[model samples]
Target chain A: MIPLSHFMIISAALFCIGLFAVLTKRNAIQILIGIEFMINAAILNFVAAGRFDRVAGGGQMFALFAIVLAAAGVAVALAIILNVYKHFRTINPDKIDTLKN
Target chain B: MSAEQLAFYFFASLTLISALLVVCMQNLVRSIFLFFVTIFSLAAMFVFALADFIAVTEVVVYVGGVLVLMLFAFMLSNKELLSGLQNIAGGFKFTHLAGLLICGGMLFLLVSAISAADVVNLSWIKNGQAISENDNTIHQIGIHTMTRYLLPFEVVSVFLMMALIGAAHLSRRERRS
Candidate 1:
């Protein structure tokens, strides 16, 4: 049996990568992609932890809800990004600085 | 290492490599495709962890639904934006170094925490006997969702509906001005 630490290590690495993507990416869509990675990394953690809670499967249930919410969030974010593109002609977050003082 | 360890390592590498590619790849379309690989590897990791139901849901909802929606949005956006390979003209110049430092620090901290922590054998087998057949996760999850988790389930449904409406409203083309 694979140790639980293995899963934890993988999820941690995934989370860091996602954080890097979110912090460094300038494109709105790329930021959204990073957010998805981060969410999936958390989901991985939940499912891996759920492997221990075999009785109620609360972790799995929470993971399900998280996945649903992530899909909803992505849908809304993509729409917003699309609207931003329409108004600004560019999806780069830095270039869309109309609100800057 | 056992077969399980081998599979775990394979999926873990797959997920981590694609995730790195998703962040590092400058081409937007290529990055999106790499994101797909990352999500798929994550689902496979879920399967390795024995969350079969979640794995299937990840594939259906994330790969089938969310990714298709993202692709549609990408295609619908400007043509020049799609063809350009260069990143945003002058963004991320200063932040790259800062982001690298922060993320690298976070990774080091997390790894250290995991290593220093006590390793408990949290595997599901209780006592000498395995969990009974009725302990099948899908069934248990269904029961819990209807009972203990009913509120969250209903809330998620409402949230999804609201999001659908909000996205439609937000993306609608302006007819005025």
Candidate 2:
């Protein structure tokens, strides 16, 4: 049987990678992609931990709710990004300086 | 190394590699496609972890719905940004280096924590038969969603409806402007 630590390690690595993307990427869509990666990493952890909680399946249930929430968030975020592009004419977060003083 | 172990390693590597590519690739469209690979491998990993229901939902919602929406948004937005050459056209800067350092430190901390932790294996295992017999996850999830998780489930549905309306409202072009 594979140790639970193995899954944890993979998820951790995935989360770091996602964080790196979120920090470095200038494009709003790229940042959103990074955020999606982070969410999936968390979902991986939930499912892996859920394997041990066989009776309640709380982990799986949480993962399900998380997935739904992520989808909804992505939809809303993309809409907002689209609106930003409409006004700023650029999707690069670094270039959109309208809010700056 | 058994079949399950082998499968786990394969999917895990696939997920990690594609995730790295998603971050490294500059082309927005290509990055989105690589994101597809990342999500697909993650779904496979979910199956290996015995969350078959979550795996299917991941594919349907993430790969099918969210991905398609992202692609559509990308296409509908600025035409100049469509090509790979023009997307993210810039040199490396200080932020990239900072991100590397931060992420490297975080990875180190997380690995140490995982190594230090003691994960108890539940006695629910009965010669592997118990694991195989516990395949009624879908039924269990359904029952739990209707009972213990009913409130959250209803809230999620309402939240989804709100998001749909919000997206539609936000994306509509203004007449006066």
Candidate 3:
């Protein structure tokens, strides 16, 4: 049987991948997808943690709330990105430098 | 291996692979589609992990609702975006190395902690088939969400409504009249 450690490790790897994507990708949508990946990794970790605490199920409940929140956040972020695209005619976040350092 | 372990492997593999595809694919539409696959697999894994309420919410809010909205935005935005794509040759190298180091260190810490901890008897896996029991069931989740977590739940609902109104305002086209 695959232990909880395995799940945690895989989720950690996925989280790393998502971080890498967010850092490296220039497209706003790609970054959003990466953000989704990161959140799901946390959800996976929570579920794995919740397996032992089966009575209160706090981890599972938190995970459910987190999933909803992630979706809402992504929805709003995408809308902003789309608005940025309309003004800029491109979605490359690196080049959209209206308020950059 | 038991059915539980087998199911875990199947769903976990699907989720991870699809997630990888979501990040790696070059085409935006293809990446979005892969994202749907990833979310679906994750929800399935949550269900197998005995988080039935979470699984349904994940599928409903993320895969169904949010993804559709993202797809709509993609369609509304410009289509010809080939030249704008970045060449990942140089810009991300150092950031990627840093990310690798951070993630690897965190993984090492987590594994060591799990191995060193003697706080709980992890040898006792919960009854995987006993999800129907009232303590961890959907009924308990609903009751707790309404009673104990009522304040935070309402707060989140208000936050969501605010977000919706703000998004509509932000994305609205300017009137030229």
Candidate 4:
């Protein structure tokens, strides 16, 4: 039997990778991609831990909701990112500082 | 190691490598395409974890819906996106090191916590066989959603529709002043 620790370690690794991408990447879409990775990692953790529960499957239900919410979030974020690109003609967050420091 | 162990390692490595490339590669197109592989392999990992329903949903909702949408967004706004792609090697900034440090620390902490908890022999492992045998995750999920999780299910549907409509409205052409 594959232990839960294996899955937890993998999910943690994936989350860290996503965090790295989100922190260092220059493009807005790339950051969104990192966010997707993080969400998937969290979902994997949920499903992995949920394997213990035989009756309720609460973890799977939560994963399902998380996936749906992620899709919706991506849709809205894409629309907003596209609008930002239109206004600034650039997707790099560093350059589009219209809010001013 | 057993076949299950080998397969789990295979899919896990595939997901991790592709994810690493997706983040580290300088080419935007390569990263985007690699994201497909990463997500698909992750679905396989979901299967390994016995999340059968989530495995299918991950593929359908992610690969079918989200990926295509992202691809279209990329094609629509092709310019200025790649300018940042080639500059990674020109100068390694402090942000890069900071990112690496923070992520590495987080991974270390997670590992330490996992080891401390003794998750391999949890109290529930006595029923591990029963859990594995009852692989009808879809059926379980359906019953729970219909009975216990009915409210959240309906709420999520409403949330999804609202998001789509809002995205459409937001992305529509703005009238000139």
Best by DockQ: 4
True contacts kept of 3: 0.47
Model 2 B-chain TM: 0.86
How do the predictions measure up, each by TM-score?
A: 0.90, 0.91, 0.84, 0.94
The whole-model lDDT of each prediction reads 0.83, 0.86, 0.75, 0.88
Worst window of 10 by summed lDDT in candidate 3 chain B: B126-135
Candidates 1 onward: DockQ, in order: 0.67, 0.62, 0.49, 0.74
- Per lDDT, what order, best first? 4, 2, 1, 3
TM-score of chain A considered alone, across all candidate predictions: 0.94, 0.95, 0.93, 0.95
Q: Pick the TM-score winner.
A: 4
Task: Give the true-contact fraction for every prediction, in order.
Answer: 0.79, 0.67, 0.47, 0.79
Lowest summed lDDT window (length 10), candidate 4 chain A: A92-101
- Model 1, chain B only, scores a TM-score of 0.83
Name the runs in model 1 displaced over 4 angstroms. Answer: B82-84, B87-92, B119-135
| Global local distance difference test of model 3 | 0.75
Query: How close is chain B to the truth by TM-score, in each candidate?
Result: 0.83, 0.86, 0.77, 0.89
Model 4: per-residue Cα lDDT over B1-177, one tens digit each = 999999999999999999999998888878888999999999998888788889999999988988888888887776655665675646788999999999999999998998898887786755554357556777778799999999999999999899989999999998989
Instruction: Evaluate residue B44 in candidate 4 and report its C-alpha lDDT on the 0 to 100 scale.
Output: 94
Candidate 3 lDDT by residue in tens digits, B67-135: 898788777774776433433323546656776687667667766775676323445454432333345
**Per-residue lDDT of candidate 2, residues B50-104 (tens digit):** 8899999999999888999899888877577656336446677899999999999
Interface RMSD of each: 2.4, 2.5, 3.4, 1.5
Order the candidates by DockQ, highest first — what do you get? 4, 1, 2, 3
